[model samples]
Every structure is written in C-alpha cells, then in structure tokens.
Target: MSYGTSFNYETILICLVAEVLNLLTTFIFYQVLKIPLFFDTIFIVAVVFYLGFVPAICVSIGYSLINSFMWICKTGFFDPFIPMYGLCGILIVFSTWLFAKNKSDFRISVSITLLYLFLIALTSSMCSIISGGLIDYFHYKYYEVTDMMNPIKNFSEGFIIQHYPPIVSYILAQIPVSFLDRLIATFTGFGIYRSFDFFMKRR
Candidate 1:
C-alpha cells in the first residue's frame, strides 16, 4: 500500500496484463461473436463466472505460490486480493443477469437494458472511486504520503457528482454497438450462404 515500502511491481504488472487480456477477450466476444443483444446479457454473466470464480482463484493462487518462493516478496500471498476482485466481478455479472432475465418482451428488454446499463456504469465508477480511496488511505498510513489521499478524495467527489452524465453517455453508445453487432451477425449468415452457393455452382 505504501509508495515507499517497495511497490509490488510484479503484482501491478500481472494485474495490468490480466486487464489487457480481459479487454481483448471482451472485445472479441462482443464484435467477432456478434451475439444478439438479448443473448449478450447471458453471455456476459457466463464470462463473469470464468473471470471471477475460475481465473482469479486459479491465477492468484498460482502467483502466490511463485511469490512465496521468493524471499523478497512482501505480501507473500494473494488469496485476500483475489477474493475481492472475484466478488466484484460476481456482483457485476449477477446484477446484469437478473435485470435481463426479468424483462419479458422487446420493449421491456430495451427499457431494462438502458436502465441496467446506466446503473452498472454508475456503480462501477463509484466502486472504483471508493476502492481508490481505500488504497490511498493505506498508502497515506503506511508511507506518510498525505498528498495521495487528497487526489483520491478529489476523484471520489468528482465521480459522485459526474457519474450520471458519463453513465448516460455510455448507455447511448451501447445502443449503436448492440445494433451493429447484430447486423454483422446477420450479414455473416448471408456471406456463408453465398459462399455455399458459389461452391455448388463450381462443383
């Protein structure tokens, strides 16, 4: 937590790598698979299971084992942080799934998706802010870096005030992305059909 107490570069590196991998995986799922909007809700939920329950527990334990072998590793374990990240992933997934499952029709689905998307964005931003604040607190306590606390506090306040506008913008952005994904999916079937026709003619 402390800046002066020898920062865990390895842990930060691993987390950044994991985040990049997750982002790429998410993009592939959304763009390449082109899953239907209705089905995306379910897919997102399943992905959360993989990220939270599977990878976090597995990767963290593995990292911890390696770290424990090194005499210089400070924390020497990873179970504590892994469970927190896993729990957050579970909450995000479960909330989206529950909201999606409740809608019974197209109109309801659109309405719920918009509402849930906004809530998710807001909650995600706020949670990040809060976590940053907690990390700052630890940093200040451990390293006597009072300046770090101020920035975190400012970020938390700003997020609380401005979270809704960004959330709304993100929901609006998703409207087009969802439509495009489905359109691509439809076109993929057409392309396959045309290819089959061409092959038959050649034969």
Candidate 2:
C-alpha cells in the first residue's frame, strides 16, 4: 500500500478506537452512574482537557462511524443517515466546547451547560429532519412529519414557521441533561484528583 493507503488505514483505526472509547464512556456513565445523555457533555469536556482536539475530533468521528454502521446494518446503508449522524456529532462537540470555554463561575457553568444542551437538542432535531428529508428523497415519499417539524405539525401549521425555533425549543428541553452531566463530571473529577493526591502524598 502507498502512503495514502497507510494514512487511510490509520484514520480508520483511530476512528475505531475513538468509537470504542466513546461507547465505553457512555456505558459507564449510564450503567455505573445511572445517567445518560447529560453526562455526555462532561465526558467531552474531560476528553478536551486531557486529550485536546485529537480526542474530541476522534470522538465525533467515531460516534458518526458507529451510528452510521448501526443505521447501515439495521436499515441498509442509507446515504443521508451517514451525513446526518456524522455531522451532528461534529456540531454537538464543537458547540459544547464553545460553551465550556466560556464558563467561568458555577453559575456560568450552569448557564453554559443549559445553553449547550439547548443547542445540542436543536442541532440534533435539525439533523433528524435532514435525515428524514433524505429518506423521503431516496424513497420518493413525503413524510408527514420530520423530527423538527413533528411538534409543529401536531400543534398547528403556524406553530413553528421556521426550523430554527424548534431547534431552540429542543435545546431548552435538554437543560436537565446538561445539568446531570455536569454533576457527574464534577464528582468524577474530584474523586480521581483526590485519589491521585493521596497516593502522591504517601509516595
């Protein structure tokens, strides 16, 4: 294989490792801590601090890959779903990082987390809409409701005239998820730091 081939292989390996790590972290948070969705922000933040951009990028890419694979295996390799999952991960991580960086005090952190959750939900909803649209395109069928449009359709025709408002509402709904994630991150970070300190003191 040429250098390009080697690089491609390496990229795939990295993506696989990242996917495994992402799943492992999510599982631990869900099973051990009994919380999911909320702690994802915390995990991403921790990864950012410990491993920086590489890990963040890998996490996003890995998430996309795993989700895409699942979609493919379950529903046959649909093209729109691939971009939908992949792009959503990237956007979520990017938005989360932006909010995390702006956080200063506890209040700020909370606010940021809430904002982050809102943005995530909105982006996710949009992605879902895009995914649905793609499905409709490929299948040549009209969807009565896309993810972002469902609530509006259910409520009234003019309930949400544009996609952006629904995204905002979705993000607001994710506030609790963000709060839970932050709480878990704090406890986990303190526990690990204290353990390290105790061992260092003895040494």
TM-score of each: 0.31, 0.42
RMSD of each: 15.5, 9.4
Point out the worst 10-residue segment of candidate 2 by lDDT: 149-158
Candidate 2: residue 53 lDDT (0-100): 46
User: What pairs collide in candidate 2?
Assistant: 118-171
Task: Report the error of model 2 at residue 158, Å.
Answer: 18
**What tens digits encode model 1's per-residue C-alpha lDDT throughout 8-54?**
66434444454444445444564466432211122233222222233
Model 2 per-residue lDDT tens digits across residues 121-172: 4553444344433343332233233433122132322323444455443444
Give the Cα lDDT of each candidate: 0.36, 0.45
Shift in Å, residue 109, candidate 2:
15
C-alpha-based local distance difference test score of model 2:
0.45
Model 1: worst 10 consecutive residues (lDDT sum): 38-47
Q: Give the TM-score of candidate 2.
A: 0.42
